[model samples]
Target: MEGFQQQFIISVFIILLGYFFKRTKILKESDGQTIARIVFNITLPALVLVTFNQMEITLPLVSLIVIAILFGLVAAAAGFFVFRSADTDLKGMAIMMMPGVNVGLFAFPLVEAIWGREGIQYFGMFDVGNAVIVFGLCFFIASYFANGSSKFYLRETVSPLLRSIPFLTYMFVVALNIFDFHLPTFLLDTAEIISGANMPLSLLLLGLYLNFSFEKSWFPLIGKYLAVKYGTGLVLGLSLFWLFSDYPMLANTVLIGFILPTSTTAVVYAIRYRYNAKIAGTIVNITIILSFLLIWVLASFVAYH
Candidate 1:
């Protein structure tokens, strides 16, 4: 636990430091989503594809990680319903729990920095598993909100890659890597530049979104969403950590996984489908704050034992 406490203290500092930078104008206000788009569409896909192509794997943990994320996503959805606090207005809240990582910004570098490339390899291993589940289920949520409202359209299968730029971006990268294609140096360099801008910029964009809230009429019910975000994240993540502790690979696994909340990926998708974009942003903002403490606790646990 000593290792957990020390690393947790440090991790919490970093997380809060981000919040401070956001509040103090150090992060500025403009260019949040543009950077997010760049990272999602360009930077992340490149880093992931390059890394996946480049890394040597002795263990095929990608499937395992995917299973784990799917389990978590299911549980998160269950929490949203069983807790039954916010279902009446679930239109805005469901997107927050979309399956994915804080990859690129939080998990990608954080895992690499903490556990090195091996960690990222494992992270990549699990990404597709989470992606399929999250994106697929997100539509279900969208359809729920569409609710005979004439806004919902159900696809018989996965939509075209063009339908999902972020997913396609990584899917494209992964395909190129698996096929052993070499990218032009100029393209690689461009990816590095855009991805480099994802973190600080995303944080500030978060700050701007966090500034908005439901109208005064909606404040009381906001707690239901807050409850789902923090409560499910902490309880589910920690529970998984404890259950998996006997497995050696559990080393750095949970910390590496929950680095950030459900990403704005859901928000972007929700907006495209017209479910409730602002609600998605609110969940992202609030979840990011809750995660500061939860991830620190989880990270400390991993760092130590």
Candidate 2:
């Protein structure tokens, strides 16, 4: 308990530190992209290699990947039905933003701080399925609504997954592990050095990009997002917890996985699709704050050994 509390505090403090840097203009908003590149292309990939290289692929872990994909689809469907009456312009943004978890950049730092390598490995596997929603379905939805007549192309949507450094690293490392191939000591040592920076760099990047603005127009949309996202998460997460009380790790994964904030890709889609950027940005910022609090409460339960 004490360890969990300490790590949580450190996590919050680091996030605040990044916010301070951005608010004080020590770093510009555009600089966030540079930091993200470092985290994703370098530190994160290294972390993936270091962790997945040793973990064996198991049936449960494979199930987690499938659950993540199914959960994403369900969440998106729920959002669409819940807000079916919303204006056509706003409906697309709402549905696109509702489903996916920010499993990588947002959840990884906290998971690593609490449960170390195994936790990361679990979430990394879960993210493979979620990636489809983030890079594919959500993108397609946004584009569809943005241009009224856009068609879904598997190649176009899946391109982001193919280009993702961390995703490729995950696949490479997992393949090597399954084949019982050994990574060279020198390579693993180098990766450990780089991967050590992953958490702080990711948290710092999150802080840099955090933005919130109050708008009367956005409140209802934000409210609906909270109710749909967290509300659905709470019911499903708790049910999973009770169902698999003996398997604390898997149960907790289900809980935290659903509680994770909306994918940042939602905002990207909003902007690219020419949807209501203000509402999109507002929901993203607000949900992030709420998710931090919710995850903290959850960490108290799941972070224990």
Candidate 3:
């Protein structure tokens, strides 16, 4: 817990520094965009390549993936019903946006910081299902609503998944691990070097892209979305905490996983589908802030315990 507190405090400082730079115009929004692209295209893949290759797959790791996916499906179903009264676009968008966790950019860095490679393994495995929802289900929902058609093609749904560099790296590493083949040491070292940039750049990218501007009309819906997103996470996280009290690693993983902010990937979906990207962007920003506070509180409780 002391380790978590110290690391988290440093992490928050870096994030706030990013926000400060953007606010002061020391770094433009375009700079943030460029940094984000580098993260997604380069650094993140390196991190995934390094970590996924190194993880020792086990039943518990597999279970974490299963639980994450199940939680997402349940959340999506609930979101559909909750937003049933909205118009088709808003309804579909809300449903798609509400469920998936942001493990890559948000969870990984913090987990790696607090719990090191062990925590990364837990969350990375959990992201197997998360990638499914983010690159598959969420994309389809947004596309369906944007086009005003329910027609779903298997190719359309999966193309983005296959196209993702990090996704491909994950699959490649999984296959290698399963077959008992290891990456060359030189290659692994290169990946480690690149991945070292992932955490700071990612947090700074979040700050650079942070936006507070939104239509006043979006307020109520955003409020409801946050409640469903964080509230559901709270209930599920607390239950897992109690159930896995003896298993600190699993318990803490579940708790932190629940509080991770909305995926920046959602904004990508919003843009591609010509949906309300602004609202999606706003949610991303807000959730990051909310997740920090929530995680801090959770960490405090853990320390006291």
Candidate 4:
């Protein structure tokens, strides 16, 4: 318990330090883009490769991929129903925001801190499904609404997934595991070294991206969005946790994964599709703050219990 608490404190402090740096002009918010690129393209992929290399492929573990996809689908459906009366642009924004969780940037660092490789392995599989939703499904929703066209562009939908480094890394490592093939020791050692940076970099990037400014008018919409997202998350997440209580780690993973913040990609899609980027950024930021607090509470409960 002491160890967990200490690690959590350190993680929060690193995040604050990143925010502090940003405030002091030591690192601008724009620097977050470069940091994000490094984290996603380099550190994160290294961590995934190293973690998944050690993980054994199992029927139950693979099922997490399906669970993540289904969870995203359910959330997307809820968003559609809840925002049925909104304007086309807002509806598109809401739908795209609903489906994906910020597992890579937000959850991975904390999960690594608390549960180490074991936790990563679980979220790793969950992330595979999440990547599909983020790169494929969410993008499709944004594009569909943006163009207001009946046509579904298969190439555009599929291209992002193919180009994503982390997604490709997940597929590569999982395939290697399935084939019972191991990377040479030297490669694994190099990957392990690079993977060490993932946690700190990710936490710091979170801090760099933090912003509190938003139009006051967006408050009601943001509130409703949060209620819908987290409300659905709590209902489904807790129910699944109850069912999987026999497997404590798996249950915790599902609970945590379900409630994670809206993906940073939500803002990206908003910018791409010309859907009120300021409001989208505001929504994502708030979710990060709320999810961080919620995860801390959950961690405290887990520790004491």
Choose the strongest candidate by TM-score: 4
User: Which candidate has the highest lDDT of all?
Assistant: 4
Residue 281 in candidate 4, Cα distance off native in Å: 0.6
The CA lDDT of each predicted structure is 0.56, 0.85, 0.83, 0.91
Tens digits of per-residue lDDT, candidate 1, 50-140, equal 5555444334454455555565566556545654554544633453354454554555644554565466666665655556655556555
Clashes of 4: 0
Clashes of 2: 0
* Tens-place lDDT digits, model 2, residues 119-162: 89889988888888789878877877778867888898878999
lDDT of 3 at 61: 75
* Model 4 Cα lDDT, one tens digit per residue, 132-220: 88887898899888999768778887888899899899999988988889899999899999999999999999999999998889988
Question: What TM-score does structure 4 among the candidates reach?
Answer: 0.97
Residue 229, candidate 4: C-alpha displacement in angstroms: 0.5
| Prediction 3 global C-alpha lDDT | 0.83
| Residues 1-305 of candidate 3: C-alpha lDDT, one tens digit per residue | 67778888888888878888989989988897788778878998898888877567787778787788887887788788889899887887788897777888777777778777787778877787788888777877888778888888889778878888877777788888889898999999999999999999987876777677888998999999999898888999899988989878778878888778888788888888777888888988899889978988886786677
TM-score of each: 0.70, 0.96, 0.93, 0.97
Tell me the number of clashing residue pairs for each predicted model: 2, 0, 0, 0
Candidate 1 colliding pairs, count: 2
lDDT of 2: 0.85
- Rank order (by lDDT, best first): 4, 2, 3, 1
Residue 196 displacement (Å), model 3: 1.4
1 against 2, candidate with superior lDDT = 2
Model 2 TM-score relative to the real fold: 0.96
